[model samples]
Target: MENYNVDTVLKDIFDSKDSNNWKPSDKIPLVTKEIETLKNDLKTFLKSSDYNMDAILKESQELCDETNLLVSGMEMCKQEIEEETMAEILHSIENHDRLTKELESVNFALNIVYDVVQCGKYVKEFDDGREAQSFTRAVEAVYDLLQYIEMPAEGFKQLDMYNNTRHTAQLILDSLLSDLYGEWDRLISTSVKPGNKKTTITITLNIEDSLIVIDVLNALEKSKKLVEKVMEFSQFLLKDVLVPIINNDCIVFAETDELMTITVNQKPDFKPAYDAVIANLRLLFHYLSNKLNVEYYRDNSIMKMMGKQICAEFSDILVKDCLIDTIPNNINELQSYGQITSEIEDFQHFLVIVKFFPDDKISILKYVNNIDILFASKSSQYFLETARTIMLKDLSVTMSIGVETIPEGNPGTSADVSGTEEEALKILNKTMPRSLFYFPRCMISKTAQELLDLVYVMMEQAVQCSDVVCKKLYNTTRLVFELYDAVVPYHHENYLQTIPQYVALFHNNCMYLAHNLQTFGDKWLILMEGRELDYPISFVDLVQKLRDLGYRHLAIHMQQQRKQILDNIRSSDLNCIVVKDVLSDNAEAAVRQCLRQLHLLKNVWIGVFPINVFTRLMATLVNMFVDELIHRVCTVEDISMEMATQLTDMYTLVVQKAPLLFQNTTDVEQYVKSWKKLQELIFVLGGSLKDIEKHWKDGTGPLAVHFNTEELRSLIKALFQNTQFRANLLSKIK
Candidate 1:
């Protein structure tokens, strides 16, 4: 409000020397009033007017200039202070270097302590368990040193200041950790000892050594027992537990009406024992998770694999026990199957047992497959044994047999019966009744479905299994499959060497097999439908798997039998014409034998022998019969007309036997070819050439009327077997 001269008042205040001594504090009232005025002016300018920088700069220029001069002066003072502080810091650094050298001298004195850590670097060479022993001294050395890192911040500060000490300490710790890791690697290597035949004694000497090695693994003070826990679980579970239980020689069984049960008490302490190991391992895993930078799953895999192997062994033992108890009883009951034929007392029992097999099989498979899966995942032998058990249950005869003799027991009062054939009577009487039991001549005991099931178990268990297991499975399946042929000889050396019995048994057993296979295939398909049994494609279907299982010959044999049955199975036409006994019959009896031989030749014979071979076989038998008949008739002491007439009747009957033997045109054609061979002999057997012609031309003799001299001669030359007989007959023809 005081309007003094504006420019001159401020210029005087700026230029006056007195202003230097004048404290701004003393002029606070004037400065406060001036600020009040400027603040009011700014408010007015913001409300109404455009900004004018020249006017604003003119007002604050003095204050701004003063602020810049003060800042420059303060900056110069700060630089001078900083220069002196830097010189002092350099002196402190020089002092720190001198102290570090002194500390280095102290560290030189502690070389004895560093020597323990240096022991790890020297332990590069590891001997048997001794290499790990060298690590023990190193571990003990660094055990105290590792705690240095774990010390409080202020405590660790002492080491942090001395770089050489910290570096040397770190190197010692690294060396100890490396040696400890090497020891762990050793433990892991010793955990499994495969290739031992007795897997029950699973621990190798390396594993035993692992015990001592692990005890010495007292490194990394925090995780000292971590190595032992891992090794103990991995090695001991299989060796100390699984092996003892599997290799336990104890056999325990309890029988019931329905089935034989393996005592649960016999199963080893596998789960409880494993669970305990798992509990310790879980803690070990937790501890190792912190100390080591490793995958949780990978670090524990060695133990897990061992655990699975234990499970495999446990399942196998349970299964083996189940089979050992049940199979013997099953076979004992199976032996009673012969009772269905001969012993009728247990007829209902036999029926029930046979009928229950499917259910029994399912039950057996339920456990076996579970066991098989355990091993299929880990071990090969579990699979091999499971596949092997199905047949091992009844390792006796391939055929089913009835008890024929009572050994050293009660009898039907007679010591020996007159006229009873020695062979037949021997079966009737016995010192040991069961021992005399042999397969009934042509009767088959095992159902085809049962045999097929055996094949499935043998092969399916081998699926996804190891190479060694697959080989054993293949060889065993082949061996068991051969039992079918032995029990019921489709083909055997005895059958081949003995032709007459071969023909009879071949037809009977062939039909037995054909009918049974058809039933088996139907049931097997039904059983398998909608069921996804884990099998290789070759084994998925029973029919195909049998072929792949080396039972290809048997499978093909069944197929041929099926074809022959479809062709026709004439059980009534079964020929009992014994070729060996034919020569013993009288002329008329021999004629009847010839007719019987012809009847057999005509009927369709289904067997291991194909139709072509069957036809040839029949032709040979018929030729032999006719040969015996001719020899018997011609060699008679009296060559009278009556005898000649009797020969005509025999020849006629032989020819009559051929009329309806064949059902088809092709078969008839084949029969006629064979018939022509017989006709040659018939001409010679009828009489001399003149009488033969009478018999041939005459309407009376059926064969003679049909076959003339040239035809008969051609038949003998073409198909007749005996050359001397052919010559003798042909000479008579001339």
Candidate 2:
């Protein structure tokens, strides 16, 4: 009935504002009356015939289309704002690209300038002592290049050229410095005078500077593989060139004294070049020592060379003296001691002569004096003795040095037996010296008596030799006596069988010497006196005496003889008799006598011998007699306690008191017996004591029934009756 258009109504309301301002109360009454009238009219219109609804729906659809159009316009405005932002980003990217290219160009130009400055400094160092004009030109060229590098550039392409140019300039400067150094070395080495060479060269190189010194040292260290090359150059210069030039007589300069005087007149000039060369060599050695971990000294090798050079110089001086007739020919005619022979005998003979002659009377007194001086100053008696021996022997044969002979009927005889036709005999007399006679008398004098006693002991202990020659030199009876005395007392029977040959030879030598010297009259007497021989007899007579005495068959039937003597003693009715009377006058002689008797007894008694006798035989021989019997007992599977104890004690005694004397098999067996005896005694005694403790109170008459008198008697009888016990007891006899 009253379809209102809001925009038309709002426009009507705004347009009527000026009119409504005319009267608000009048407008309100008129509007209210018109609304009531419009309401009545709408109700009347609705109640009337149907109005057109299709036309109204068409107008509503047109209003919805207008709202959709307005929303589309707002979306289009947002898209236009985003497109403007994208345009601004594109413009910023182009600006960044332009700034990047400019920065790269600036960096490149700066790098070029830096490199050019470094290269120019190096070039200036290289050309430091060159012509000013040339140096100035080179410096200006470098400056111009630097300027060019500093010129403004647009991009990296232009700047890259500046960097390349700068690097090329550095390369050129390095090459120029290297060439200049080479030329400078060559010029200094060649152009300087010999006397001024060191100073000029040192100033030119300035190798003393820290940087320069380090470089040189580093180069030397790196050149280790070139050692052989350096050595070869040194050898060529010193040996091939310098040595020969210095040695040349034709190239002699002013006399040394004159040159030294003139040089002294002038102020001393410092040798910088010489010092540089020395420093260079020192650096080289230092590098080698560090690399190799060795001790290096410059003076050591140089001094060795200098020594050889000095020797050569001295030889040259002598040669020059000879050429100039500065020394007389007679000066060379002084007595020449001949070359020394290395033979020991030659040396020994020389010592004998030196010992016999008076020191002051020596013909070549200077050589003798040198020896005395050496002995006094150096305390090299051994070496001096050796040298003196050599010299004396050489002079003796070569110079025909005479040896004085003992006067006829003189009591004293010369020890030197040189030039005598009589063959020297090794007399087995206790009085003769055991050591080499030429041993310095002064040194031996302090111990002479002891040495003499040892010699006596050796002589007395010498077993006779089987040789005829030896028997003639040494008395056979004396040798046999010595063999008997040296043999273990009770075991003499065992050793007697083995020693006849040595005895026989000793006798043969003694006899031969006696027979040969008989015709020499007092000279033979003197020789005998020197040998200290007790009695002189022929070798044949001595052999005959030995044969008559049964010594010829002693070795063959010694065991049989010893057994016979044992049987005789065991069966003898005489009880408690002195063993000495039963055997011989002397103790040692009695032993030999008893041994022979026992060997005979063994053969006679054979199987009739008691077990105790056999055991005693073994023990006796085992204790004092070591031969097959002792060996058999030692190796036997079951050794009795008694035998073991005896062996232990014997061993202990021998080891402590006289070890050297017990070196023989028989003696060693005795010593072992002593040791075994001591050990067994300790064990048995300890066991017995332990048993006694178990059975007895602290103090008691008898510990137990087993320790009673009757029981002890029985045990004692059993022990004494034991084969080992009997043997051990019997062993102590002969």
TM-score of each: 0.30, 0.20
The sequence of per-residue lDDT tens digits that candidate 1 reaches over residues 339-358 is 33232223223322333112
Residue range 602-628, candidate 2, lDDT tens digits: 443222222232334434433443232
Q: Score residue 589 of candidate 1 by CA lDDT.
A: 60
lDDT (CA) per prediction: 0.43, 0.35
Deviating ranges (above 4 Å) for candidate 1? 1-141, 144-226, 229-234, 250-503, 513-620, 624-704, 708-734
Provide the lDDT at 610 for model 2: 27
The 10 consecutive residues of candidate 2 with the worst lDDT sum are 257-266
RMSD of each: 22.9, 31.7
Query: Alpha-carbon error at 527 in model 2, in Å?
Result: 36
